[model samples]
Target: MAFGKSKNRRRQDAAQTKEAVKGAVRSHGPGLLKAILLTGLTCAVVWGGIELRRWALSSPTFLLKETTFSGLQRAAPGELLKLSGLTVGQNLWALDVEMLERTMAAHPWVRTVEVRRHFPSSVSVEVSEHVPAALAVLGDLYLVDEDGEPFKRLQPGDTLDLPLVTGMDREDYLADEAKTRERFRQALEVARAYAATEPTKRERLSEVRMAPEGLVLVLADGTEARLGEGDTDAKLQRLSRVREELRARGLSAGVIHLENRARPGWVAVKLSSPASERSGASQ
Candidate 1:
């Protein structure tokens, strides 16, 4: 009976120790569960971030599929596309807009350029090109803008009824752009004056040759108008008057000199052979 009591006591002790261990585990159960949940959340976030990055980089949605150009006149689309340096299947977000603009604007025809990147796969471009105002006869003919900026070489396809500005050296212009530009401005003024005048006088303008003495106008009828350097407007007015008087009398002059600034009112005219003989025959 004593042995049996001792065995029962040992069983009781074992039961109590098991219960104590269970109680300890239960007390720390919430903290263990929270630690496991935090680790799982951190791992999930890292995995999700990696996947998002991968998707963003390799996704077909962000790839450049189309490129479009607008506001173009003289600029060729193929040349514009070539100059843009943008290619299909390129990354849209990786496009350098500034670099693209610089490259396109470097084209001879492009006056200004605006580059835009559209999301989900497109690029749009705005190109402003230089408009030809005159044909500048340097070594070879060059197209000059209204602002006197020489932009491009004359092509056979370009059939513009613009006036020619001669006696300008390309090297001289390259050496002194400012001086050349000033001369161009004066040439424009002369051209504009002709435009404003009557068609009879305007039709006579063939070429404007810039001379060291002044501006010389070479007419279609082999007549030369010598406009010396003083007041250009005054010179033009005198020229118009002389042209009108001569035209009214059905007379023609070989050289009309307005260079005598000392006698601004008096115009000296050298008659052509036909007109000279006619004047003599009339007198």
Candidate 2:
């Protein structure tokens, strides 16, 4: 009877162990299967992306067939295309748009450039050229853009009848680029102020000389209009009235000093002849 009881106890223990194993498997089986499926999906996606990129780079279907250029004023399409190093037979997907843009931007006249590749067979380039605002005499005469950047040297046949900016040294520019550019911008501001105030006298504007004292506007007839910093528009207006008065009096001025910090509204005018005159601009 004792032997039979021990055998039955062993059988009961084995049966309990089997049930526990089955319960654990039932709890964890679905989660394990889901994890495996997710890993397979992620690997498949990565492989697909790699293959797609490889095919796009090597496929002839994406070969560039045509290139179009727009917003080209001073630059020729052929010239820019050559500079870009983009060929018709090259794969559009393989071409670096940023590199092409950088290369094209190296051209002196290009202020901004955008290069885009159209799907399957074409590319387009858009460029914005710099507008010459004034000529900066920095050792070599350079074309100053509207933003006051001296972009290109004045080449032969580049006939721009703009105001000449003097007293900007190239050595000084190299030493402190920002300060020189600020000076250039200030001179440009004076020119614009003069133009806005006296549009009819635009043609009379010849040179903008940067004197140690301030900015001096040298007219076509060799008259100097001294304009110091600040209140540019007001000073230009005063100058316009003074010029009209002089014209009415059938006289021409040699030097018209409108920038008197001591006596703010007073203008001193020296006649082109032997006689010199000082007058109040406020009147």
Candidate 3:
């Protein structure tokens, strides 16, 4: 009887051990499988990416693709392309777009530039140029943009059809000139006003001399208009009214004084004496 009891106890103990082992395996099995699956997926993704990049770089057709440029005239295409530090047969995957754009913007005439990779191999460049607004007579001469900031040295004939700004010394020209630039602000306004009336007014603008009295406008016909520093809009309106009235009356004048706009409307207008009459008047 004692031996049978011992045998039953042993059987119960073995059964409990088997159940514990089964339970442990059930809990850990999914975790092991999941880890294996995740590792495999990561390896597959990394390998695919590397293979794709390698294939793209190894393709000869992409390396041989041609690069193109637009809106480039002053600078040679080869020169600008060289500044980008790009060459034929370079792996497109290794190209740095931001660096290329920064390099292109280094050009003096380039106001804005865009650089983009052309798929597998080549790069395309598009550039916007700076338009000259005024010319500053520095030692080497400088081209000033519309904002009155002097950017780069000028070449001969580069400032054709642009207004010439005089009377500023080298010190004023080299400085930022933001405050003094307002001196020409009214001149720009007048130039535009004339242009609105006549497109060829740009050719008529000879020089803008900044003097102690105020701004002076020298027209191509040797007619001078005194434009004071204050209340320019009012002054121009008065000038326009006077011009219209004179034209209606078939009268010609040379200098138009816009200095005083009192109740009496004081203005000075000139008429060129006939060549024969000028001799008699001088005599």
Candidate 4:
């Protein structure tokens, strides 16, 4: 009987230990499942981000479709577009903006180029063209800009009614920009002064020829005015006074020398042909 009780007791202990292990698993199973699901979600998010990036980089939808242009006045849009060498279907990522800018720079009328990409759809180009300040005669007529840059040769179709600036070779102007620009500035200054006159008076100034001594202003009536270097404003003031006096006297001159530094109050005028009277005036 004692041996029988001992075996039964061992059986009871083994059964109790099995029940305890089942209870522990029941308590921890939900927490372990939650931890595994969270880990899997993080992995899926990382994988999705990577795939999206790859798709965007290789997608055909991110192509150059439309091209818009601005700040283009004198430059032809078709010509500038050709200069850029851009096509509608080019991949935006592979577009070489710097090369396009360099190509645009090669255009004679283009002063500056700006190229931009509109993501997923289009491209834009802004071109600043060289603006003509005067017509310079350099073997042939050319459009000279404010910065002393002569950009384009004058075509027969171009307008002919602009102030003429002469006396410098095109190659010489291009070779020495600094020196050429200073000379150009002086000539431009003379034009500005003349342009300030009354509309009818200003229209009479047809040419501002650069001279070894200074400037020679030629009128439409074949009258010439000698404007020596410096004191441009003072000289113009004196010229105005002389013009009033001449108009009062009903006199037209072939040439008028106004570089009257010695007698700042006086002007010398030579009469036109078929007239014998040479005259002088005091302001």
Best by lDDT: 2
Off by over 4 Å in 4: 1-57
Which ten contiguous residues of candidate 4 have the minimum total lDDT?
195-204
Clashing pairs in 2: none
Candidate 2 lDDT over 214-273, as tens digits, reads 899998878899987678888888888888888999989999998899887888898898
- Provide C-alpha RMSD values for all models, in order: 10.3, 2.7, 6.2, 8.4
Q: What's the candidate order when arranged by decreasing TM-score?
A: 2, 4, 1, 3
What residue runs in model 1 are displaced by over 4 Å at the alpha carbon? 1-57, 199-204, 274-283
Query: Which is superior by lDDT, 1 or 4?
Result: 1
Pick the winner on lDDT between candidates 2 and 4.
Answer: 2
Question: Is candidate 1 or 3 superior in lDDT?
Answer: 1
User: What's the count of clashing pairs in each model shown?
Assistant: 0, 0, 0, 0
lDDT of 2: 0.89
TM-score of each: 0.72, 0.88, 0.71, 0.76
RMSD of candidate 2 to the truth, in angstroms, is: 2.7
So what's the TM-score on candidate 2? 0.88
lDDT of 1 by residue, 142-219 (tens): 988888888889999888877788889989899999889888878878877866663664455777888888888877
lDDT of each: 0.81, 0.89, 0.68, 0.80
TM-score of 1: 0.72
The lDDT, on a scale of 0 to 1, for candidate 1 is: 0.81
Sorting all predicted structures by lDDT, with the top scorer first, yields 2, 1, 4, 3
Which predicted model would earn the best TM-score? 2
